[model samples]
Target: MSASELVFPPGATRRDWMADGILAVSLSLVVIAVPFVWLGGTQEPDPRVVGVSLAMLLPLTLRRHAPLLMLALVSVAGALHLVLLDVPSPSLIAVPIVAYSVARWVPGHASRSVLVIGTFASLLGPMRWFENTTSGNPSVDVLSWGACLGAVLTPYAIGRRAREVAESRGAEVRIAEERYRLLLAEREQQGRLAEASARAVIARELHDIVAHSLSVMIVQAEGGRAAAARNPDVAAEALDTIAETGREALHEMRRIVGVLRAGPEAGERPTYAPTPTLEDIPELVARTSDRARLVVHGEPGNVPPALALTIYRVVQEALTNFLKHAGASAHATVSLSYGPQHITIDVQDDGEGVEDPTDGGGNGLRGMYERVASMGGSLRAGPRTSSPRFRVLAPLPAPPPSPPPTHRRS
Candidate 1:
C-alpha cells in the first residue's frame, strides 16, 4: 500500500463530533451555573458576564476538529472577560483545554504560536485578577502568574509528549515491515539459486550419459558393420555391446526422469541403480575399447561415495574425449595413483589429434572439469610433448578418515 492510502481523509469522524459535542455540552452547563454559584443565587447575576463566558466555553466543540479556530474564539472572549469583568469565571478552564488541543492537533508553527499567546495570557490574566485586590504585592502576583502559566504549559507539554511517542511507534512499525520485505527477497533469491544448481546437475548428468554411451555405440556399430562379411562372431559381439550400452543409457535416463517427476507430496520413491564408483573404472575402460588400458600405482583405500562418483565421471569423460578426438589406431592408458592425501588420475592417448582437447566448445570436457573441481580436485587436458598426443591429468583430495567402530557393552 502507498503512503496516501494509509493516511485518513481530512475532517473529523462521527465519533469525534459526538464525543466532543458531549464534552462541550457538559462543560457549558457547568460554565452557565458558575455565576449563580459565585452569588449563591441570592441575587441576579450580570447578563454581559454570562454572555462572554458562554462565548469562551461554547467553541470547545471544535477543540479537536478545528483547534486553531476554537483557540481564537476562546482567546477573544477571554480578553473581553478580562477587560469588562473584575472576577474570574469557570469558563476560564477552556484556556488549558485549548492549549492542549492546539499542541496535539495543529502543525508546529501554528502550535508554537499558541505558546506565545498563552504565555502572555498567563501573565496578563493573573495581573488582571489581582489589579484591584493585591494593592501591588509583588510576591502574590508572581505566584498567581506562575500558577496560571503551569496550567497552560502542563497540558501543552503532555500533548507534545504524546505526539512524539506516537511517531516513535510508527517508525518502529515501518522498520519491522521493511525487514520482513528484505527477508522475503533473500529467500526468493536462494530459491532461484537452488533451481539453477539443480538444472546444472541435470545438464551435466545428461551430457555424461548420452555423450559417452552414444560414442561407444557408434564406434561398435561401425566396426560391426565393417566386419559383417569377414567375421560373423566379431559382428555378433559388437551388436551385443551396442545393445548393452543402449540399455544402460536408457536406465540412467529413466533415473534422471523419475527424479524430475517425483515430488515430496506424491509419496513416490523411484528405486535408482547404484552410482558407479572407483572400483567400476576397469569395467568402464574395457567397455570403451580394447585400445585403452588401465594402470594403478598405489593400493586403493576407503573412498567416500561422492569422491568415487567424481573419479568415475572423470575417467568416463576422458575416455569419451579420447575416442571422439583421437585417430582410430591410437592407444590410450588410464593410470590411477592413491596417496595419503590425494588420488591422481591420468588418461593419455598416443593419437594424432587436436593440440588442445579441452579447446572444443563442448560440454564434455567442461562437465568433467566442473565435476572434478566440485570435489576440490583439478583437471588439465592438452597435447603432451612426449608420446601421448593428448593427456588429461587430475588430482583429487583424499577422503577423510572413518570413525573407529564401537563394540557392544554386553
Candidate 2:
C-alpha cells in the first residue's frame, strides 16, 4: 500500500478527517469539563488552564498528517500545563497518544525524541502535581512515576513494533514486484533472440534457393536466345531447362510458405518434400551448367541431416557466386572429400577474380561463413593467391562416432 493509503485509506478521507476532528473536540471538551468535575461545580475553573489544556489536546487532529509538528505543539502545551496547573487535568492523556503518533509516523532519529520526552514527562508530571501530598504509602511518588512511564512507554513500544512489521511487508512486496519485472524482461529478450534466429535461417534458405535458380535461368535463357537462330532443337532444350528451374524455385518457395502458415503446433503433417542432402549435390551441380563439375575423393558415410543441408547450401551458394562472377565460358570444379574427422568442400572457378570488391561484400559469403561456423566448422572464400581465380574452401567437423553394437546372451 502507498503512504497515502496508510494515512487515509481509499474511500475514507472524509471519514478520517471527521473522526480526527471528533477526537480532538471530544478530548478538548473532556479537558474543559475535568476542572469543573473536580470542583463539583461549586467553583469556577481558570480560563488560562483550560486554554493550555486544549492546546495540548487539539494537536491530535494533525497527528497522522504532520506528526512532528503535532508532537511539538503538544509538548509545548504540556510544559505550560505542568508549570501553570496545580491539579492533574485529564488533558495529560494526550501525552501517551502523542508518543504513539511520533513513534508510528515519524521515522529515523527524529522519532527517538518521543522516548526521551516521554521518560522526562513520566517522572516530572506526577512530581509537579503531587509534590505537596504526604501519602501514607512512602513509595507513592515512585509508584506514580512507574504508572505514568508505563502508560507512555507501552503505546510507544507497540507503535514502533507495528511500524517495523509494516516496513518489512512493504519491502517484501517491492522485491516481489522487481523480480516479476525482471522475469518479463528476460522473456521478452529470449523471444527477440528466437525471432532473429528464425529469420536468419529463412534468409539463408531463400538465398541458396533463389540465387542459384536465377543464375541458372539467366545462363540458359542467354544460351537459348543464341541457339534459337542457329538450331531450334538446342534452343528448345534450353527453354525446357529454364522452365524446370523456375518451377523448382516456385515449389521450394511454396514449401517454405506452407511451413510458416502451418506453424509449429499444427496438427496435420506437412505435405512438402524432404530437404536436400549430400546425395542431391551432383544433381544440383548438373543443373547449374555443363561447365560445372563435381568430384568425390573419399567414401561418403552417413551424415547428419543438418550437416548435409549445410554442405548442400555451401555448394549451391558457391556455384551461384561462380555463375555471377566468373566469365560465361569459365569452368568450375566442386571437390567434396570425406575424411576421418572432417567433410571438406573446395569450389574453384578458372576465371579472372571479381571485378568489383563490393560485389563480393554481399550476404552470400557472410551467410556461408555463419552457416559453417554454427556447425563448428570454418569457411574461407577469396581469390586464389597463385592465380586470378575465386576459391571457396570449407571443412566441417565430423559427426560423433556411432556406439558399438552390443550382443545380449539369452
TM-score of each: 0.82, 0.82
lDDT of 1 by residue, 12-71 (tens): 788998998888888887778766787889877678777887888888888777787888
* lDDT, model 1, position 81: 88
Model 2, 212-284: lDDT tens per residue?
8988998889888999999999899999999999999999988887877785678666577789989999999
For model 2, what is the C-alpha lDDT against the true structure? 0.86
List runs of model 1 lying over 4 Å from the truth.
1-87, 105-110, 354-360, 386-388, 403-410
- lDDT, residue 203, candidate 1: 91
| Counted clashes in each candidate structure | 0, 0
Q: Where is model 2 more than 4 Å wrong at Cα? A: 1-58, 83-85, 89-91, 135-143, 262-272, 354-360
Top lDDT hit:
2
Candidate 1 least-lDDT 10 residues = 1-10
